[model samples]
Target: MTRHPSDAPTPPPAGTDNGPAVSREEFDALFATVRAWGRWSPADRGAWNRVTPDLVRRATALVRSGTVLPMARPWDTSPGPDNSRPALHYMSELGDLEAAEPSAHKDFIAVDYHGKAVSHLDALSHVAYRGQLYDGRTARDCVDAGGAHFGAVSALGPLVTRGVLLDLPAVLGCRWLTPGRAVHADDLVSAEQALGVTIGEGDAVLVRSGSLRRRREEGAWDPGAASAGLHVDAMPLLAGRGIALLGGDGDSDVRPSPVEGLHSPVHALALAAMGVPLLDNLDLEALSAAGAEEGRYAFLLVVAPLHIPGGTGSPVTPVAVL
Candidate 1:
């Protein structure tokens, strides 16, 4: 029987074949090594505090041709294996009886965007590992059904900084990485060298696994279940570099998570430990092409999330300017 998009698939059995590979002991040790609980002063903004006026000015200096690319997937109204809860868009007011002389068309839009479908920003409160959010705030104390009381999307308004495009497939001479491939820290260094770009302080690292492009040509699969992205080992490098933000076609976590006892282990280490808010499910094909054409990978990246008070995260359309 053909499964409908609305129908959730039966979860595979958990073990070495399906679940995370690393043991609990290994995952915990790695978590403690990179945890930055008390580093940032005002913890709501998290690692974004690293981006300063000087860094923004420096980022602006990277823009030469002024080519702009918006890195958001189209408002996804269709449900699929990846898009479990599809975005909603409909004309609420056609403005026939409501308007006097002039007619107007207005639409209402909403989404459960933190999944694999939408390009969005994940606030620090979005992920809570071991009952704690960023800066060691207890998740139960800070977040509730009402919404997050700390590290809400409103606090992370506009982020503008240097963006590094690690076009992995381009570097590897492939169209796309296989779904479940893990990108280690060595891949980052190799990609940087191959692309003639170096990631400095306060940079927003945008990695392109080209999974979305492959899905376009091939077919849609469950990215949340299996997607090519950075492993937990890769986070230490970015964390050490003082990255303001991290983003990718995937949510920066390779699955089956290298770490056991966690589904999104990288998310936990990034948001909860390193205080690094994440940008997830970006369509970086345009950015990849732009980088190849220009022969440069670093550019001025800009992200502005909706200012929803106490919101856990926001649907965002990040732009890369070269």
Candidate 2:
């Protein structure tokens, strides 16, 4: 297989006779294709570059004509590893009302381990490889008197662009994609055909594996259970397509964590190495349904990560205007 610049090392390629996973060189070649298509810049330009004004006009018309819909789900508790991450906490305050009834107030705190909720985008400063952050900045450089860094969600601005949802489960003949299932580039193409839309450059491509539904129904995460996610080989495909953001419903499809046992190497590769953003734990059920019903794939996509400074990831509410 031809290697792309953005392709990370992967197992041998898939085979008709169950051969080893894709070779590293072949994976690299695939990634190179993605890298070649990307507009490598730190500025906040997203998938809009790939969208034509005509497409935007059509989407707007559909919204005005009530042919398309906006799909956004209300945030509830987030999912985590065995519910280890606290989803919400409340601090109560009691106050005296003098001669009146006692008064109290409760402050609500939410932990966003589930990756759903109003949150900020994780800057490269949030994670490190060998202790180096984005732009070669160290964690120390990101801290000050407050010990804060660029990881805060507030650091990210409004990420406005044309968003495309690739419904992989629909293409794969399943309502719920299982864990450990690797979605390939061909799956993406099939989804595009099914949706009657073509993915273009600079689009924020969302891959829906239906894993979120299973997780929600199960009500807890099983560390040992496999979950559906992007194949490592698909990175180059995304990069080759010039996708600005690559988001999905799970952490990643790769196994065994790449950074000395640290999970989420996809974050490292996309955010740190490729300068691309990764959206996780997004609620795509409504969007998928709407797209299928309307027979359209492109939409006016809006996502605003929390502006928190020096934070790793933020809970986000992403909306799609069809």
Candidate 3:
């Protein structure tokens, strides 16, 4: 079904609209306003500090049907323009191995998952804006060729809390949003009102633009060059709500970026400024379906990253319980 342009959500606020390029001055002003440097004070956990025991308990109570869904995309191994460094998987030992006393099978896998292919988490150290990481940590001093010394994915430990899915296409009565479309604060609020849900503090908000749906139907495109996701103007609203985590099908940045001289303004704002870790390249297609089926957008979000000490980020397989 074709959706008219009139059916789209309202555009972002002035100076951040999608039609024109946002000036560097405006972007800088907005970036500084949302910066959380020195706010958490020696706390590398960043926005995740909002997730308390009470919140976790409350979220656990939300699993009524006991439905569990894995949000990670498959570990991609096929190389393409979208997947430059395809993940590796091979059999290290087969049952036919002569040295093995009994039948045995073993395999190994690895990936540089920061790009458009693999589903992965982006730690606070994953992005640096203006030479600094979260909590005013200088990139040069903390992160090096070795790995990040501060705000490593290990510091985040495990997250168990409420997860909110803002199904943009479902709420908008469309199959999916086109690439380069931007989701603003207005879209988020409208989705909440339409879905009878509210994004709250300590919540892990996942925005579904039907990106995977589009890819499956229309074939893959270069998401790095153009993708549908949250614009920079929307972050302040989410930040004001005190969200603990942010994620989407794309990297949570609308492209070609509206901000001048900034490739991914939203990433910079969320990771470096607000200190909110990100779940990138999630397969929200299933979650979108589950939410539509139950008529509830809130669920129990569980994320466990590999315990790679001093690691910048980890390849994660997050689950959402409904």
Candidate 1 Cα outliers beyond 4 Å, as residue runs: 1-20
Q: Can you tell me which runs of candidate 3 are displaced by over 4 Å?
A: 1-17, 99-101
**Per-residue lDDT for 1-322 in model 1, tens only?**
2111112222222211322366878888888988888887688998899999999999999989999999999999998898889999998988785657677889999888889899999999999988989888999999888899999999888999999999887777667777778888888999888888888888999888878887897799987678888887787798788888999998888877777668899899889998888999999988887777778889999999999888989999999999
Model 1 CA lDDT for position 42: 83
- Root-mean-square deviation of candidate 3: 3.8
Q: Pick the candidate with the highest TM-score.
A: 3
TM-score of 1: 0.92
How are the candidates ranked when ordered by TM-score, highest leading? 3, 1, 2
lDDT of 3 by residue, 1-322 (tens): 2132224454233312354467889888888888887777447889999999999999999999999999999989998868989999999978886675778899999888899988888999888888988887898999888888999998989999999999888777666777788888999999898888899989999998887877886788898887888888898999899999999988899988989889999999999989899999999988887887788989999999998888888899889999
Q: Of the pair 1 and 2, which is ahead by lDDT? A: 1
Give the candidate number with the greatest lDDT. Answer: 3
Model 3: which residue pairs collide?
A: none
> How much does each candidate deviate from the true structure in C-alpha RMSD?
6.8, 7.8, 3.8
TM-scores for all candidates: the values are 0.92, 0.71, 0.93
